[model samples]
Target chain A: MKKNLSEDFSMEDSLEQIIQEKNLVYRPTRLMTGATLSYCPGCGHGTIHRLIMEVVEEMGIQAETIGVSPVGCAVLAYDFMDVDFTEAAHGRAPAVATGIKRLWPDKYVFTYQGDGDLAAIGTAETIHACNRGEQICIFFVNNGIYGMTGGQMAPTTLEGMVSSTTPYGRNVEQMGPPLKITELVAQLAGTYYVSRQSIHKAATVRKAKKAIRKAFEVQKEKKGMAFVEFVSNCNSGWKMTPNEANQWMEDHMFPFYPLGDIKVDGKLVKNVIQDL
Target chain B: MAKVRGAIVVDIERCKGCEVCVVNCPTDVIAMSKDVNSKGYHYAYMEHPDDCTGCTNCAIVCPDGAITVYRIKN
Candidate 1:
């Protein structure tokens, strides 16, 4: 007589299955299951989203994580990020996140905001939040132009950059120089860590993930404030395919912004790529 | 001994096919499949199963929890 061995077999199998899936869902796939993403083909939004989830899982804080969404393509962050999320006013993700953190100081708060939100309308809020030394992390995604708002020029748009607003290329005399957020934030004494990284290339993406992970660690330790600005590609706005955006960033933007850390722990940590 | 074929399968029905795993695979063993899955998004696939060294790079960077790797032991 055989005692149905199904129970014993399934128990081990299900556990192993969870282990197998762990590689994919490091923090237990928080992304809402739906049809394919609405993003255009080859956009950097997907890459940055993945990086955030991977970083969240690695830190084992998915349960304690809360995200503040912005009004750009990042507005959909609440859908992709499986954790609790709240949308912020046009460019006030930092301020919105500050409120959430104040209410629940033990939680990890992150704002997934775009260049428009981080560098323009939300600039004052972002700057003041940093000044206040809020124990939160900001994931500032700078793709140069505004993706969700129809390829308009953003404050982070490089000088002479062409966009819906600047069809003839942005002239420094008229538009002023591009906003370098990492450099600007590095000046703030409240910022405990500030790194400017990219997702255009393979090696650079790896570094960006590490920087994000470190930011999460800072949040876990309740470090004053941490900011990692990702120089991501806006393929939809740039009118180039995703691969082209990556190539463009590697060729053009790398020279202007370069790659590496601007500040950490009151001292400057160098970007290794810049040395080479 | 068998050639120890280890194929990387991405559960597209289960996959958001975000392309994170495709770019993160250290060995470059996986690439987006031309044929879209049931979800209508191109899922990652191992083209050269022979070249896969059982490293599971595809599994590691997958943000959607969709990849499954089989290591066939003789």
Candidate 2:
């Protein structure tokens, strides 16, 4: 009986029909290459990469944008993103981005750096670039520990946060307090837009995307440095499940690195620190 | 008014089975599969296809960019 059936009854035809009828609401942006991300499962790095690429695609600036990724887990970021990318030395992404932006003048330049690369060894370059009002966007991912190096205590590691080096958790007096690099950079006169965001949840993801778009827009206007900090989670480093890490980030990390704009339109938006 | 229906395609290879989408799905439409992918992770799939609104919440929160959402009006 089945032999008499029409060829249109084939499985492929039905799938084609279904696909033709449905509207594609969301698909992975083409700006991201087919390379599987090196980031661990549930890491925010992939999401941030997607958001930045999506913004560049939506703005029709894919050809005009250049990215600099320095040492750390994201050192191989260029392999995943399709846009033009340059690999900088450890903690030198900001300087590389500055050079690129200065050379091109019209090109949109940005840097992707991790907490260890940005807040620790690269602190001098980060501050100097921002202080000089380099026309570039800085995407800082602060997971609080050296994720790539087996979870060493980073400069931004929260006080009392356990790490491989700090087996007893971070000691504030000895290690000093966790550096609020986002807030510190915001105090620089050159930064035009400085904001901190997280991408753990759907709502926060949307807000983070908006912040990234704003940063790019600020760059397009030839404004001073636009710094965006993403307070992310390092599940592997933290020894927690992906979901548990996000929840822990909410409960602990958010209190110290609150998500919001510290500066806007070349002016300080709010005093993030009461004492300082 | 026609009823709106939504569906999703999970790229099995790309999904890392992190369960971020499972927790973010508003309709409870997604769940980790008992079967494992090539990477040995329990990837996410639509367990309740009829309930999905194509809100894109799961896709938005997906760290691996493995899920693509589609919607149709009946």
Candidate 3:
């Protein structure tokens, strides 16, 4: 039986012989470590992480890039990304990134933050960093809920959205309207480039990649702050399948938080979505 | 002129069976495996391998970055 099995194996080609290096089209960037991501399946955090790493690798700035991870689901970003990383206190990524960039003006510094950390706990830090025109990039992932904390309603939670804290859906009357932190930051004179994008579909992923690359380029040019907001989906937190969550995001979230450039090169773009 | 053929290698252990890549493949060449991986998720595989286009759509939408695409002109 052992001799027969060995003979059968010899008849089939090995995997290495089947897949040649020259035929490769796309592979994960080496900037990402081999560690298995901790994010739930279908969560946008993984895609966003890969995009950022791809940008860093493509631009040949792996050694010069510094990322400040926030206190949310992506706090373990340091584990997944093979780049220089520093952990920030709850909602203080912007402040931490500011200091890092100030000390090394030539290094590219950026913060990876979630809605709970940026729009809620770190509101003051976020505003001040942008207001001061810090030479850093802020990558905000707005999933509308505190995913790391078991689906609690965050400051950016949309109206009528349901979360663990908001059992009956978010009520604007009492809880106050959902904060538009991206637009608010774009209004500040310090921000150089500001854009809102998503990564659910292939086309959108391409656009998000461009936005990330642009943000880093803006920093390399010693420009003022560049803020990119990604309206993402939290499948586990939102209690929906990955596909359903993405569709729901398009149907509801995109209307509330439209995807487009709010500001570019220190100038505000007109025709901003005004309907609340 | 040769026909453009493509293939994809999926990291089974890393895949969570989210089905995002299955839905995004333009050629509809990918499908969920009837067998589950060690993690008990129905991982994706190229059901119609001859139909692949090396578009990179699946890799782009794969949140886990498990899919790698390769192309050959045959």
Model 2 clashing residue pairs (backbone): none
Badly placed stretches (over 4 Å) of model 3 are A1-18, A272-276, B1-4
> Every prediction's TM-score for the first chain?
0.85, 0.93, 0.93
Q: After superposition, how far is residue A179 of candidate 2 from its true place, in Å?
A: 0.1
Candidate 2: segments with Cα more than 4 A from true spot: A1-18, B1-4
Categorize the docking of model 2: acceptable
Model 2 compared with the native: what TM-score? 0.93
TM-score of the first chain of model 3: 0.93
RMSD of 2: 4.0
**Model number with the top lDDT:** 3
Candidates arranged by DockQ, highest first: 2, 3, 1
Q: Score chain B of each candidate by TM-score.
A: 0.74, 0.90, 0.90
User: Which consecutive 10 residues in model 3 chain A have the weakest lDDT in total?
Assistant: A9-18
Off by over 4 Å in 1: A1-35, A270-276, B1-6, B13-44, B54-74
For residues A65-96, what per-residue lDDT tens digits would candidate 2 score against the true structure?
Answer: 99999799999999988899999999999999
Q: How would you class the docking of model 1?
A: incorrect
lDDT of 1 by residue, B1-74 (tens): 22323556666675655566666666667777888877587767776554555555555444344665655433
